[model samples]
Target: MVALKEALARNGGLWIGCAPEQREAPSNELVMHQRPDFDIGLFELEPPLYRDFYLGYSNSVLWPALHGRVDLIDVKPRYAKAYRDVGRRLARLVAGAVNDDDVIWVHDYQMIPLAHELKALGVKCRIGFFLHIPMPDLQTFKAIPEWQDLARCLSDYDLLGFQTRRDLSHMINIFRNTLRGELRANGTMGISGREVALGSFPISIDVAGFRELAASGADKVSPPPLPRLIGVDRLDYSKGLPQRLAGYEAFLETHPQYRSRVSLLQIAPPTRDDVDAYKAIRSELESLSGHINGRFGTVDWTPVQYIHRALPRTELAVLYRLSRVGLVTPLFDGMNLVAKEFVAAQDERDPGVLVLSQFAGAAEEMPEALIINPHDPHDIAQAIKTALDMPLSERMKRHSALYAHLESHNVTRWSTAFLKQLTSVERIGPDGVAPLPGSTPWSRTA
Candidate 1:
């Protein structure tokens, strides 16, 4: 959200999305918020339609399938129709607002079919799409009922961006093996007379902004009482929260002397609570945390601190700076920005060690971190022990390497590279001369 908002503020475009406070209304009016640099348009949808489209299809069906949990996908017969209906409605709204030459950049899994719907309405504009989640393997992706339809919808885009090379390769294999698409020499896939370019663009945080947050106001808040290890993530099934808690339990059981000296602080805010899977995970985490605390807590010390709510970013920065280790072990992630943020928030003199998951996309860039297989509680426990006992010199060296990478591949660079590539896609006119994709040629002058 921050990256796209900054991009719109700089490049001058209208940001359109669903309204935050949706009510049961029949009118398709777009509520407008006019900013100095850009405009935001929020459209309304009926309550039932919104429920089926977002909660039912997007979260319950596509979310699990994309995360390689096809067994958990609960797709009703009406879900496919609801998804298509929502896309058609949004396309009509967008076609009415956009110009003929505007470059449309769609984002995430929810809007995969928007470009196809837009083109169906006779809108001849170049549209690009970026998928933020991990693209599943061939058999996993093929398990989805509407795989063919989804692949067809994806081919309508001029370009497709993924978070990692593995994800990009998986997508390319799907196109070549299943769809019989021809891979050209220029790295574009030709299908149904349309050429689509695919690339990996790992998203990043605003490094300078986060560093400012970390550096400012150190005296306002007191430091933690114990040697803390932190894990901050949304309360989702893919985050591996239960396994993380179990790993902490294993660490304490194996290393008895460090029980009172160190603690694991896991901060996970609720997400998609209305879904059954989310509710089950939340219940499981609560039970596991309770069990760990009951088994390890003394009169003066608690081994696990489970916070189920959100905290301010400034407070989080302070926590990250003061902790002894950052435990980010997701089973699979597109790119966990919290790992990068932890690196950015560290003190150079005495930095915290990072225990990351090999399955996360960030592991590709941050090889200096102590990478562990998240599926193994023993591996996570051993890595945590290594991080907690590492010398100050080794910690500083690892943090230095990680922080330098974050500085070079910050969020601004990510957005600039994506938009540059999106605008540079070759589109020939009637006279064989190519122009810029968007109305205003993309420039960095702003």
Candidate 2:
């Protein structure tokens, strides 16, 4: 939200997002924090529509498919209808307040169809979209029942943004091969005569914010007797909690000596309890954690501390600082900010090593980290070993690099870069510094 505020500092405006509550709630910044610039609108959905649109289409279908888990997709006609209806309602809600020059930037897969609906109503404002998840492979994307329509709807935007070049390329292929949209330079695409600029704008966290949080007055929970490895994630299947536990288990199995010298602290806060998959994953993780702890844990020391709740930012920061290794091994992620936050929270003199998943978006930015293949338990175990055994000089070097990159491409920069691209699409030339082409002219001026 700070990034959004800073990006729109010159022309302050509000952002809109769907909130699943009893009723529309006031902005937290307005009510709690007493910050005036906190202009976020959260429109509450009808119970039935929320079930269909959010729990059904957005999470059930799009969330899994976009993450390349098409097997989890459960499509229904009503879900799509609900999604479209929500978009229309959202447009109507803000249409009266939106000015002619307002740069409308809809976010994530939920708003994929929004721009198209707005265009249908002849709202000629400059609209942009950013997908916060992976674009999925062509095959996986086709699993969505209204894939073509969804692609066309997204194309209605003046610009589209993904988190990585790989994702951007996959999306480009989708437009060129599936939708038959014209491809152009600089990620600009020509789809049905509309020139849409699409590119990778990797999302990042607020580096200073995390560091400040870490420095805040939060008492350190006395560390366990052994050195710690910390993993914090929502209890989501895609986070590879099972695989991560297995990796640690394998590490202990292979190296019996470390049973007394090291421990794993996994903090998984629950989310999406409405979905059966979430409940199942939680049970499975609990079992796996118990198995690992039982097998290796002594009466004096538990090998794994499995927490099923969220902590305050300050608490998490202290934990990160105390950790000897930061274990973030998501099977697939848009951009795991945990990896960056761990780096930011480290003490410069003796920083903890990051054992990151190669499948994560952070892997691209964190080459110095001990990257591992999440699918291979051996690789993860080995990476953990490497991180733990890494020399102080090497740890400092890796953390320094990681911290610098996080500071450079922080959330503010990310928002500014994407918004700049979104607003400057017309300035692009025939080739280079632009994106793939479209048949339709995006604007009359172009």
Task: State the lDDT of candidate 1 residue by residue for 377-438, as single tens digits.
Answer: 99989998999889999998998999999999988888888888888887534321222222
- Assess every candidate by TM-score: 0.94, 0.91
- Least lDDT summed over 10 consecutive residues: which range in candidate 1? 437-446
lDDT of all predictions, in order shown?
Answer: 0.84, 0.80
lDDT of 2 at 197: 88
Please provide, for model 2 over 306-407, each residue's C-alpha lDDT reduced to its tens digit, 9 standing for 90 to 100: 999999877888889878999999988988878988998888888999999998988988898998999999998898888888999999998898898889
Query: Which structure among the candidates has the greatest TM-score?
Result: 1
RMSD of 1: 5.9
Q: Stretches of candidate 1 above 4 Å error? A: 428-446
Reference-based lDDT, residue 124, model 2: 62
